[model samples]
Target chain A: MKQTQTLNHPLDDLLRTDRIPHIWCPGCGIGTAFSACLIAMKESGINLAKTAMVSGIGCSGRGAGYVKLDSYHTTHGRAIPFATGLKLANPELNVVVFSGDGDLFAIGGNHFIHAARRNMDLTVVCVNNFNYGMTGGQAAATTPHLARTTTTPMGNPEMPFNLPLLAWASGATYVARWTILHARDLAESIEEALQRRGFSFIEVLSPCPVNYGRRNKMKPMDTLRIFKEKTLIKNNAQPTELGIDFERGIVLGKFVDEDKPSCGELYDKTCRPSLTQGTAA
Target chain B: MEPAVLTGEHYMTGDEACAEGALAAGCRFFGGYPITPATEIAETMAARLPKVGGTFIQMEDEIAAMAAVVGASCGGVKSMTATSGPGFSLMMENLGLGICLETPCVVVNVQRAGPSTGLPTMAAQGDMMQARWGSHGHYEIIALSPSSAQEAFYQTILAFNLAEKYRTPVLIMTDEVVGHMSERVVIPEAKAIKIVERTRPRGRKDRYNPFEPGEFGVPPMASAGEGYNVHMTGLTHDERGYPDMSVECQEQMVNRLVGKIRNNLDDIIRTESHRLEDAEVVVVSYGVSTRTAYAAVEEARELGIKAGMLKLVTVWPFPERQIRELAGRVKGFVTVEINLGQIHLEVSRCAAGLAPALLVGHCGGTLISPEAVIEAVRRIV
Candidate 1:
């Protein structure tokens, strides 16, 4: 990758080029999703100096290490709370939690829901590859029903989490979903989420070819074809019907966006002594 | 507006005093979950932090609380959390993360009885060793224990100071008795309290290394969002704070972390050497057990057995050298604690067979009376 030293990468300013050749596998989609995030972060025109990225343990969790901003690669399932602390401690900071599906939904599921419930001013991007890619393609909380994995050789009996629906039910003020193939739409959605207030969640459907794809008959190209051919762009679609079905078209778009008061704003209004509106503690 | 420091005399529980102490120490962030014997610290922080322009969050669990505390500290805030044994157990994973990242924060473990929910409302000193090595992997930790509410306030401040100075997690090991017991505590003036601020990174921001040690073996911390573009991880990393998976990198990282505290034992270790000059039998104790041990030592002295109390103010480094030195002079040692035998093991190991360290202990829920401690001291005499 370093053979062409003269070529300048557009995202160089946002990347730790020294830690290039990241740990992502050959056909992994994390890099594409991460690039979208960086582009969105840059395009949003927020104070980059005041923005911090936090990630948990996984393929996508490694994104925090590669980011050029002040970043934290936290423990598994904990990126959300760590980001919450960063945001709440200093309201001036724009905290972003970027991690994989297993890290956010499995071990760190409780934190994800609570952060959303509080309507914290955070932009959370979950890269859903349908399995624990880092741990040898084991079954994950987001693994589709009857999907094959290392841990579930007989096919997964558990139904995958509908991430957008979960975020909706958990009171996220903004929610969207896009695949790695739709990088422009995903980046636009992320930029929109960054501009909006309150807890914003965006799920990127990325392919884990070495792990999830190899178990099924799908290869890297086949997964990309599914992302392109077998998806529907349905804006404001009902969250309950927003499940991922490879053969039956999976719906994707900006689903929820509202200008609700974030956790910090509400906390200042309610908990502080100089509240003019009211008080609940 | 309620000032962070309430400078006056007040009758309050140890937990409340500890909260006051943390506020006075410039701890502007507290993320905690409610647990028995330590809930007051969180409650007080929640009420007081916002008034002082700080932040207090009741997280979903102790793990999140610990993670949030570390995150707040990394975000340029002095952060803290309080919990019981079970919650403290949950915090171990993230506490290790804080240690690995060299993030400064304070954790208050108001320990209770049992291996699992033994007696949530009761007291125990069983987690003494857990505070030192509870987190996975071998790393040095600083822990302080308090015998009374007054001491709890001071120790909480000290915990923050040590955390800032060393750029590591500091544990305040108080138990159910001291945590819940109400006593007179005098909050000194803000100017009187010696608060330690974090040492900022010095040099060009573009060329900064987050983990490179400064003057006393502690790296100057650059909190998140300052534009240094620093990276922090739980994996073994180089001085630049990027992951370096080589075995050599692991050795350098671990050695410097352990050596940082080990080299400054004099500044970190705190103990009260009472009546040891003329005493032949020394009673090793800490936390609330020190109260009973002091009475026992005086009783033993009344009966012509020269005994003294060695009050361990800071317990994590274990004061091994002091124990070894005392072992040479004292004929024997009597260790007092509420647990079956935690610190006794340390005293015995440090004593190194030069002195016989006998344990007067029980399985928590109650304290070993002065009579039992005295009996143990008599056996040693």
Candidate 2:
């Protein structure tokens, strides 16, 4: 049987093609993460006219500038609150936040957790490249234990964050993870998350060729090869089955899926009494 | 005084009167957080707005509450937010955004004592400086002060009109006394009152840039999805709404923002000169403090002291030219507010270095009575 592939040509044109000799050398996971977002948007069937792309300050934040949509390049770590305002102001609009590991988990950690707990109706695509690429490869919250980078020249002493597990515990309705090598799978996960009714988070294990590649002494192609080899997409494996070693990066799928009331829907049903005849106590 | 349209009213607090005024002005969206003294305004809006198909939202925080009103205003609704000192402080950043983006909205600040969490239910006019320069950067502002509840309702309606006509944020600077005091106010029919809607671009969508200033230096606003790819930002922007940090662009934008109010000072600046026709001492006051000044002037008239009162209705853009004109004849000025010597300085400056400007003010909570203002007037006289 022949397979059907829905390629996103408009997104491909919108990408940095001329930089084809890209800032990111070949095999970088950023390209994979980027492709997944384009495919996800195409598959979600959301009206581009009512869609807004908001991002914070980071290499991942540059994703907003890349997309030919209504975009907001807000202050560092403030994308969640900004997108929150945009979503609540116009509930019909599809608001998505594209952020980096540092932008989402470090400075923006408070907003990230609260937004999840609040269960605001929006999609968050967080690209975890393990290190701060734009700022000369500093060790980020997502940097795996003992990783070497500009900040962690000898070895990273701090523990890494399990982003998907954190999102699940924090009340996010949908959570998933996929590496850049599984581009089609990553896109499918993103599409599923977007279609979900509440706060949806997709953690993409992107690779920074300029930072992660150079420090790890691996070529961009080798990084993609490692992603493909290390990732384990398990349908029945429990959380204990997946180990935390860098070589065993689990490609978790459909980790948490449940029906919960979104903040917008709840707000309309509760706070707004004038719209209906019901009274708010 | 043109035979007083609605006179002989009493027993109303300033805050309750402000609510009556908001209803009279047809304010539909009241998004706010309840703070002391300002709670009455929100409570009033909640009770009245829903009756008229208006929407009221108690948002997550003051920032969101303020932003929500701005958002609702863009959706073709007259919106307002009320807060005390601290909440007002929090709304400044977005207030500046409102100014730069040219969004028409109103914010009412019921002045209370503090640098941080001072008397919550008390009175002070400490935010006088803040009302003019609270937000960062330079831009024109229109602030009004009502000395009585009657004026509070009238001034609130006037604030909305000025905001819409100029496409700027208007501050209703009321103190705890004026905001919470009770006084009778005459409500007029909706048709008798005038309302202003923002100008819309006359040309096709493609030719419009949201920040492009028209003949009045106020850009016509087009809401989102109106087929106009309008761009707005807090940064200093050019005619096309693109951020232009160059010196020329900054100069042009700043000039237009300030000049719109500066040039229209005659029309925008308002004040009532009481018994100033032939008086030796002119007492300057605003908010609830002006009520005491009025009583002082009447008492002084009986005592043959020749004291008149200058009640400021428009607090910002200073009414400097009018004060300068008045300074030519008046012997001295006595300025009184809840706080220590805020508008007193402005009165001094506007006196053109002629008359001696004395200040009578209190620190926290409680109004400086008419007797104290009488004493100040007596000293100046």
Model number with the top lDDT: 1
Per-residue lDDT tens digits for candidate 1, residues B1-381, read: 578789999999999999999999999899999999899999999999988888889999999999999999999999999999999999999999999999999999998997998899999998988998899999999999999999999999999999999999999999999999999999988999999988999889998999999978999999887889879999999999999999999999999999999999999999998889988899999999999999988888889889998999999888999999999999999999888888899999999779999999999998889999888787877
Q: Can you give the lDDT of residue A3 in candidate 2? A: 96
lDDT of 2 by residue, B226-268 (tens): 4454445555778766556799999998898888788788879
Best by TM-score: 1
DockQ of each: 0.75, 0.14
- Model 2: per-residue Cα lDDT over A91-197, one tens digit each: 66777888898998897776688778889887999998888887889999888888899989898998888887778778898877778777888899888877777
True-structure lDDT of candidate 2: 0.76
Q: CA shift at B149, candidate 1, in angstroms?
A: 0.7
Clashes within 3 Å, all models in order: 0, 14
Worst 10 residues of 2 chain A by lDDT: A14-23
Report residue B60 deviation for candidate 2 (angstroms). Answer: 3.7
